[model samples]
Target: MRIFAFVGVFASVVSLIGCATGLTRAGSMIRESTDLSVRNRCEFIGTIDESERMGAGQGDNRRGALNRVRNRVAELGGDTFLIVSLDTDNSGAYVQAEVYGCGTVGSSASHAPATPAPSGREGSMTTGSGFYVSRSGHVLTNAHVVEQCREVRIPPTGTAEIVARDDASDLALLKNDIANQPIPAIFRGGRGVQPGAGVVVIGFPLQGIISSGPSVTTGIISSLAGPSNDRRLFQMTAPIHPGSSGGPVLDDAGNVVGVATAKLDPFVVARETGDIPQNISFAVSAGIARAFLDAEGVRYEILPSDPALPTENIATRARQFTLRIECRE
Candidate 1:
């Protein structure tokens, strides 16, 4: 009886180790999205559904389900899988994906569209910033950045498709075709916006003029409203430049509270009002962004709150999802 009990315990440990190894390996090769464009070179490998046991923690359950989905795709000889949908029921967390095979070299080439040269009157290229919001490759940026653009490039990633846009809100969503998984922005839900909260901004400003890396700025949420008391906007003291549009306004907890949109034009405002506004910038509140995503039926992640992260750590994490948006008109 003692020998049998010891054997059972040892077997369970081995099984857990095997599962962890498989998940890590599978995660390294799989890419998730529903926006693959290279069907000509790849063959469909059928859809896969994966679910995992859930306890009190939804985060752990979701991660487990995603890992299972990736593992199943790898087992079926598929290099990429597009996440069709994810949901949770009373029983567990579940994810469904469509698998594809495009040969041993991988399907990255098939996923990207051919790059075209700049053309027409808006032929010049402009750069801005954006960040990923969903695991399905959905990115959020200012609509103007990609407006009338012939091609949108998210550097170190790949070409992106303009999936949705709201000119009124100055927000746009892009679907990228990259093999690497993106770290999504954590929206700060249930946390009310407060005056004088510490904030940070990350983006690629001035491109070649500055270093090729994203720049970081720190400040505080100066006001809860914007010009004319626009409650949908947050007036922050964080300095923003021309290229800073569409970047995220993150709280000390590293949760996104708003989307950097515009700043008071000192020249124009001063000419009209005879007063120069300094360090006056505005960002669309996270509530507005959440509503936009909801209207578009885009799924996103949210966190209740997080322990305050160090400035360096926050910047490092933000860089993972923050991308340089290049537009050729």
Candidate 2:
């Protein structure tokens, strides 16, 4: 039995070694470039992805992954390639490369790359935040977040479907077939949402720009009304950014009172008022949001309790339902 097991393990390693770098003589001649100038000179052939656990190292088998990709590019008759993305971990690695067929410009020394941007030249990929609204994986976010998105994703659970949206209210509901029953956010009606009440906002702000997850910001309700005295919205002092939209604003009792929607553009405001506004933000009141869900006939959870808890405890509970909302335009 032991001998058979050893033989099986050896065969697997051999197979991995052989698959890691299926380098052809032509593949050896392939060049890698992240320069936009070079990319412009070459025709965009296609994007290729290679995923496998071909090696093990602190570098995460990057060399082996590159060789395999080079082999694929050569096979596709592409002489140059630009890495679009490279993600790896202890289990395996995944690489996305854009193959380009360049003539002679790629050989020029002047086109040598100075640095690599996070990924290859691609379309805009914006990130925001959203929270589960039901056990069946219903999510809530700003309509503008996924407005023009060609594709919408909520990581781990994969792609999500936009169920219902009300542009006027700026709220959109998304549905995902999550593997596990999600712990939805507890919506506290906006009736008792008074100014000076402590609130916690959780979201993924500046997502791809900053390598981080859900962030927590604490503040007090500045006013019962929003810009132009919009009754449907509430004003708050919590700081938020471009990617903070759609995040849940929870009260001290850990019940969601609103959805973080917009932040005052300081630069634009500074130009007009000669003073930049500080922490000026707005959110769709939970009452308005809940009404929308009710109209859509989506079942959600709401608790009547207002048990005061530690801010950290509230954040931890919020994290369970909050997730990064990714949009590829």
Candidate 3:
């Protein structure tokens, strides 16, 4: 055969250049192991290196690194959350970091890192995306990511004292022990999921850095309901931003149902009209996330065989733990 087809196309182009040089060093070691695992799950929030004599009446350098990150989050011991920055406001000097307190901070002899506040320099951290609806560890984010966090750290994983927060449905409900573990997610059951179906959305957006990972987006259900005096709300063409406000939307069988909050772009104004109405994105109904987990009593369990027939009365070990968690997702 023509010289064995030119040596089988030169050994398949040298085995595709040795698998593209081992996938370019396995994609730079998976982006430096996801940037050192999100800088070991952030929580530093403090550093302004003596803002020119301890922030002399703050008014520059990003207001003295936001007043030395509001005075070391009031002397490092009570923070719901913090993230001040000033990189170069004419270099008046700045860097204030602090992320400690929620319900999880590591180090049973391994994940130390909780002292480098910078000027002794170390600055760089991030770990703020959330999920896990309720199994006991609770969790549901976006009260501006722990809002006035009086103390909320989850470093290396573990921390959540916050108990209840609604903030007009911006939602929040922390508490941690990570209970039985394996808290990925699986809620759905809001019933009859209409409008075109198919969807999926997971987050970690921006928190994992430069829009890190866990991001997956697909769309449909561009409006099964909304503004009919708010039929619990729903609308999705999928593109969301601002770290995709409180994640979770899934449905192509993954469950979840909805949670992403808002989006609405449309402010066009071009004379003889050629382009007008555009924009819409809201979501919050999986039956208002079962009325936000039945107003926080949160129990969850209704997927015995679920095809859409769910009202909740289920029992029998909660329908065999919701049919073994919908057959392992």
lDDT of each: 0.69, 0.71, 0.44
Candidates' RMSD to native: 21.0, 19.6, 20.9
Ranking by lDDT: 2, 1, 3
**CA shift of 6, model 2, Å:** 66
- Model 2 clash pairs? none
> Which segments of candidate 1 are over 4 A away from where they belong?
1-122
Best by TM-score: 2
Q: Mark the regions of model 2 whose C-alpha exceeds 4 Å error after superposition.
A: 1-122, 189-191
Residue-level lDDT of model 3, residues 54-130, one tens digit each, is: 44332334444545554555465433233333343343655544434322221111223343321232322223345
Model 3 C-alpha RMSD to native: 20.9
201, model 1: CA deviation in Å?
0.6
TM-score of each model, in listed order: 0.62, 0.63, 0.25
Residue 290 of model 1, lDDT score: 89
Q: Which lDDT tens digits does candidate 2 get at residues 271-314?
A: 33479678788888898899988987878988764678999999
In model 3, what lDDT does residue 262 have?
55
Per-residue lDDT for 211 in model 1?
73
